[model samples]
Target: MNTKPRQTGRGGPRGTKNLPPAPDNKENIDTQILRLEQLEQKFNVEGSNTLDIVYARQENDQHHATIQAQAAELERLKEIVASFHASEGALGPNITPSGSAAAGSTQDAPKKDKARKHSAAANVDDMALDERASKGQIGAESQPSGKKGKAPKPSAPTNVDDMAIDAPDGAAAVAGTGADDEGVSDTTAALARENAELKRLLAAAQAGPVGGPAEEGPAPGSIPRPKGSAGSDFNIQDAMGLGHGRKNRKNYKSIMRSCRDLVLQARIDWERPWAEVSAATKSKAFAVAEERHPILARFFNSWATEELMKQSVKNKRNRAYKHDGLEVPEKYAYLKANAAKRNPTAPRGRQAKLGRVDVARKRAEKKKKVATSSIKTKKDAKGKGKAVAPESDEDDVEMKQYAPSEEDESDCTY
Candidate 1:
């Protein structure tokens, strides 16, 4: 049986009273059609609005469901993480998979690892079972795999906040102190460096350098040099010296004869200093009487010993033999000459540095000589009735080429 309304022959509902039949006139029919079209359009607009409301409500319900689902999932994840964290400390040291309260706390490493994993897995399963039980999905008393499945108690405190807020003044004061310390440290380092440099400079200034010996004169406490060419040192070459107004040895024959006479006089003894024999030591000692040649006579033992020593020094120095004035018939001249020059490369460059005191003494002596010569020139000028005024200091510096720079007047002892 249909629940739809029965239509009478008048084309209306049966529940209503007898209704009028619509007029069959063209105008009235046209009016009724237009009214029907208007009603249909109104119904269509109302249906469209109802459909829009239904769609909006459906979207809102879906959004709310999505939010609830996300909340549930977040709760689940939180529970898993909380259990994971809690299980680490909650599992007692005695827990194990085949638990009968476990044997002891000090178990093997592998056993501990297995126990840790099993306890964590059991805790996770217990959390899931409890969760399911609250939703009536699982029994609340459902047992996990192991008997000792409960979490252990944490050893540390449960409620302690690690991070804290610091006071602004305290932080700023600390920063300022750090900066001051840094600045002070830098200043101290700089001052220390400067102090070291100053100390070095002061020490250097106080202890001045020592002057070396001079280059122009002999050293003190040394033997007075022979007044002429290097005595007994015949291989004189490139002598960078002032020569001290000495002459070359031009006559050796007369010198030996003079030595003989001095030996006879018994004056040339070991007690006499070499400086006393000034007349004999000069390079050109022409004061020796050349009238009598060196006779082949027996000489004094002392004189002969002195001459032998001099000859030995000459031989050691590789001195060249001179066959000029002296006659040496005792030995072959050719043999002596060749023997002396055999080791031509024996002698080396001289390195005789003079002392500062000796150099100063020589300079004073030269000044004294210049003064004496100037006085003599003035006296001679006075005698000639002429004014002798030197044009310059250079003009007053007179030097004779071969002048004998006679030392203290000879006592004629030698």
Candidate 2:
């Protein structure tokens, strides 16, 4: 508001002219502030999506580890069951209801041998008592010799359990194991069978859907009747889509690998309660998909799948997709490669196949090492006297570089 100009030194403003130029640090601070502002703007727009991707990756890794552990546990259980069956088989064919050696002409010989052992043991005990008495280790009144006029009644066990233990090993073995074996074997067999069935279902679930034409009744006498009807003719390979006439080995490998991830995700999600599928769960599921197969990750997320399911569900009231009950997609329908390779005769993308992940650099390096090991072995053989260096500790060995190909934006949903 001042109309009069302020008077200063010859440079116009003396204090301003003398002031030092802005420091390098001050310019850097300003640049950093601007970058931070831009970053904050980005976070406001895409924060949810970014967070979801991270969560999904973690879920996928955890799922894979769990499935691997389960498979190992199942294998161990099978081994235990097998050992039980073998031991039961080897227990000898002469087992009786009481679990004792069967009563036959051969049984008398064992009884005779046991009687001799008892008499020998009794004589040894008598000898020990006489020696103890002579040495004044026992009181004369307690000596067996003092009661010589009457034969000592054989010592009897006070309890049934004691009597069982006192019996011949063969007799006790039979008595203890006979009934228990039947019951235990029955229970174990049933449990093993159930576990096997469950494993089969899990493996099947991870594979592609079964493919076969509906079976019609066979003509009269067209085939011999089996004792039992085969409920489902499909095998695991058929379920895995390997039953196709022309095989694409690459595609098969790809499907198998992706199927493992899908199965793992399904397992983790399926265990949680269906009612708990809120925004958080939805975000997690989306993130997990994005972490692995970014191309199809969005398709399996809550928003995408829920929208897809709305039209498919019989009841409109049940609009939400059950997070835990997700199934592996039938085909890799979303992939550009799969879509391009589809048969012209069939609907576009309908018959699309799964695409394999690009082979990683570490895997390629491993293959190279394997190939070169033979040459090294030949050299070692030719120079037997040459001192070879001890191998470096595995801890000190450099780990291979690994880079997984990220899916391009062609498959992006949003």
Candidate 3:
């Protein structure tokens, strides 16, 4: 309680300057433990936080890895699916199951491994079963229930004639019996013999009196024969056109020659009608014309005679008037008139006749005028003392006015 300051040697009270350190006691230990515990707790908290971070990182890594693995697996599955679809497309819709199963095994490795062994064993068993079944079916179908399962006995051969006799009608069972056999049988033998005898008689009749005496030469009383014994020669002139009456023969030859000429002319001038042939060859030989040759006769018949006649008339009409530039001739006019009578639509015949007459009169007038002009020119030249006079019809009239000359002879030919 006294407020006095107690003086000590150094900083604090102690047993001595070198006194031994305080013994570590429970308290101290406890305190130190407490501190250690606190430190440990702190360390644990920090460690726990660090561990949590590490664990979180590890979890994140594991999650990412798992995702990657899943992605790879998905890709692999996609590839497998695509391959499966491709295989299905290649094989037809009803492809055998064994083929598909085998293909599928390649994509699903583990499953395929197991399936391969199983399929092989199954195939073996199936093959054996199939063999047994085939054998059984064959035996059942082909063999009969006899001693030791042998085949049935075949029937014995039967005589075809006997079978034919027993047949109802038209059965193949008796077809092997030939008609010759039937002919030789008792039923047909007599008829066949009679047929042979009739055939012999027919052949004998066809021979035509073989055993008769040789035909003698015609008796002296027979009709008189030609000098050549009348053997092979015979007159065929009657059969041919040559044997016709003289007029008919001449007409035929003329027609034939004309036809030949027409054909030749047609060949030479392709536009010439066959009808003009008769006129062209009027003076030619029938044989030379060759138009009536046997080969050409067919062509003539095909081109009917009436058509040829029409063509001839047309050619004649053209030749008669076309050269002079005049109207058609009388023959053509007559034809036209007849045609008009047959067909009322034709032009009038009077017009054609008038045209022809006008053309003829005009031609005559032109010729007379030419002659008169020539005579007038000659007389004018003579009067002018330039040339001698032309002796013509007009001069004759002028000369009549002058004295007649004794030397002029009317009987003299010009």
Candidate 4:
């Protein structure tokens, strides 16, 4: 048939613009899809990285917080220990912590406390024994001295009054024979007076009618009778009681002082750990001193003292070198230098004096003196040699109206 190749108009001539626009919409859709996929992937990657960073920061913060909490807890514990030690001092060593006892036992709390005290005393004795043994003080059976499987005999109570009385015998002898004879004479006089007083009292009793109970006298072996009957037995008893009371009070005061010393020692022991911790954390020697000696807290406050500041600087330097393996920065050096400047006694180089203001003042004074001298000379010259009187009388000579004397010519021969 003559209509063989009817134009289908699908594939036109090569390189023609009508060659089917290359599926532009599909290609564009594909390119847009690829860009969107790439953007999604990038967003996912960045979001994951940001989340990782956030999680890492959170972890770091938690770690730091935990460390801080631990440090705070340690400090709190130290404070608690210190408070306990202080309270223990006010309370005697026999005190027990609350809630340390249980019910239903036949022994009451006081008894339990007593038993505990005895147990502690026994332990202390054992420790002392151990110490003695370590020092080669053991006996035949390795028992401590004064403890040979038997209780020690009770010791007689020592009378301090008797000791004091005895102590004066040697002193009295050293006072010389004259003083010793005077003391004996006084004793004899006191005895004679006492005898006369007793006799007078007996006479008074006899002069009064018989029955008045014969007036009992002081017991034998009591203090030597006083010279006057006014000194009654009651006086001696009262004096003895007063002396005993004074002794008791003195003993009580001594006990209190001892307790205070023990409390101080306990406080020192309790604060040792705190001092170490403070030194480790703050790297400050003052903290250690304050922890060790609470009484010195006020003194340490003004750590600006030259010695203390120097020690602190040394501590910081050592800490920096120890922990960070680094030298002190130049900024710190400048601060230290300024501090030294503020303290006149701080060690400094002689070079610091080379450009001092004192030198400048001296130089300025010399220059001013020179300028004043020059001005004075100009003033003197401007006076026009008008027979200006000499400043000194020695320079002003009275020249008599006469020819040169013959003696002047004789002196000129030399």
How much lDDT does each candidate structure score?
0.40, 0.42, 0.42, 0.40
> Candidate 2, after superposition: displacement of residue 305 in Å?
28
Candidate 1 — which residues are off by over 4 angstroms? Answer: 1-48, 92-109, 113-414
lDDT of 2 by residue, 309-375 (tens): 2222312222232344444344534564654654457322211211111234454566567557756
TM-score of candidate 2 relative to the true fold:
0.18
The digit string of per-residue lDDT tens for model 3 on 154-181 reads 4422333343455433222211134422
What would the per-residue lDDT of candidate 4 be over residues 207-320, giving only the tens digit for each residue? 533455755554444333233222222232232222267775554333333323322322322212233333322323333334333422333232211123333344445566
Model 4 residue 223 CA deviation in Å: 58
Tell me each candidate's TM-score: 0.15, 0.18, 0.15, 0.18
TM-score of 4: 0.18
lDDT of 2 at 60: 82
TM-score winner between candidates 1 and 2: 2
